[model samples]
Target: MNRTFNAASTADDVLDGIDLRGRRILLTGASSGIGIETARALAAHGAHVVGTARDLSNAQAVTAAVLSDAANGGSFELVELDLSSLESVRRCADRIADSGPLFDVVIANAGVMATPAGRTREGFETQFGTNHLGHFVLVNRLASRIADGGRLVVVASASHRSAPFSLDDLNFERTPYEPQLAYARSKTANILFAVEFDRRHRARGVRAAAVHPGTIRTGLGRHMGQEVMEAAIEKLSAALVAEGQAPFQWKSVAQGAATTLWAGLIAAPDEVGGRYCENCHVSEVNDGPLGPFAEGVRSYALDPETARLLWRRSEEMVGETF
Candidate 1:
């Protein structure tokens, strides 16, 4: 696939002239930010999108435009899923898997960012539990429900470069809790999950890829107070400037979602499987300790051995093997 899209490209821009009639997509975090835009663009192009949110009524209220204005037989449906709870993840996956038609694509887009020290209902770190482990369990459970040749696009972050993952200290038991580092570790786990998932399923034609949506101001930052948010932004800007890269420029929701749509629908499976992508193109790996705003995948984030190890540890954490 040619690289025609950039950071400024919108989801609608990426999907233009593409027809998705009869396609079925499962998208998490459907009620907010880029998730809503992604669902709207797909449904507008004739795909049947089943979206998962913690609150169905709120999701319906927010996505009314997508449903009411769907074209070419496109449509949207909402399902309840609270990623912070393993029980909720299991119930949502079981309901969708048991209910008829198989999915053509699954976008694990829901996530929390820079949250205060906390634990999920299942006794795991809030960020890791919801952003990585939650999707780990849900996606694995639905693996059988995805049709052959299906794609899994996990919405990771360039901030994955923020910190290295520590499987041994997954819940921060030995380390002091720092919100940003915890979130970064979780994002790295997202990439590793995609790497391992693609390796495990590609032979059966189910390929998975992780994607960076760029910086976008959304409810994902609700956990960060204004002063902390400002300080973090200033620090990130300084680092990028010092590195001779442009300062961080926030992407709109549409722009943020463009890479996800591109990776899932436009890029060839072989090119994207087991890869990390951003700005609508597969990213190169940089082993250096670069600024979080820098573009490219960290070599550590894609190590096959690490990915495999994470998979094994994750299974043990959830007490279920895929």
Candidate 2:
């Protein structure tokens, strides 16, 4: 049966009773918000977690917080990873690869949203470069080291529903770039990346899935102006108060991490690979416009041909074949 959870369900709730002793997990963006909460849940479940962030100091702080509250026998290690740079991704992966333990789950959770237009070190648009391409390269580089039945969970968004893949101007070279469009494009690429990854690796006992964590109150909104934030709040307030919908379409950090935990640790890889998931289950595919908290996958985001093209382009840009 298809299961559905809500914004109030925390990572612990999804992970309750799961025994993960000896499992090793790699989590990105572990310094704050959903990433931190997810790390806490995994560590509490007895996984040997290696959590990464841009700053070693911040990563250490997150590690300390998790370890302080960890159940007996839980552990976490910190690693440095800057997703915006291919060199950084390679170095981080190389370090973990040399660590001698096969990763059982990889959560690609760090991301920026609606930030001012910029370019990564490799000259790709910042959002597409960091949110999708960075993780794409990281996963491919570490693919062989992932355990045979491991899971790769890409933290995508409902924003992908806002726009389909724009192949012609993906790098924003020929068009005026909009932050939302760029974010949507990167998220679309995330789904496509997973589709192709699963196609190539599933037969080898590796599986990939993408997830929408739902809107949550986090530093992810720091880039927006007050008016933009207020407008979003107002819309959400109206949805709950006036329309009798789920009140205030935002999840707490712990709640926001639930679907990711489920996808990473609970869902059967063969049953869920290459699909977009939310609320701890495969979301019902929708064709209409997305509601405040519900969204559907677009055809372009799941197109096999586009996935292959993006994979090839990623390799060309990163100068590494996978």
Please report the candidate that would top TM-score against the real structure: 1
Model 2 misplaced stretches (Cα beyond 4 Å):
1-4, 239-247
List, residue by residue over 1-322, the lDDT tens digit for candidate 2: 5454665778888877877888989999988779888888888888888888999986786567788757747788888899999899999989988885899998999999888989999999999999988998888888988899899999999889887676777789989989999999989889889889999999978899999998888888788877889898897778767766656656788889999998888888876799888877886667677766655677777789999998898788778788
Q: In candidate 1, what are the lDDT values of residues 11-90, reduced to their tens digit?
A: 98999899999999999999998999999999999999999999988888999988876899999999999999999999
Give candidate 1's TM-score: 0.95
Least accurate 10 contiguous residues by lDDT in model 2:
1-10
Measured with C-alpha atoms, the lDDT of residue 224 in candidate 1 is 87
Q: 177, model 2: CA deviation in Å?
A: 1.2
Q: What TM-score does prediction 2 earn?
A: 0.95
- lDDT per model, in order? 0.92, 0.85
Badly placed stretches (over 4 Å) of model 1 are 1-3, 235-247
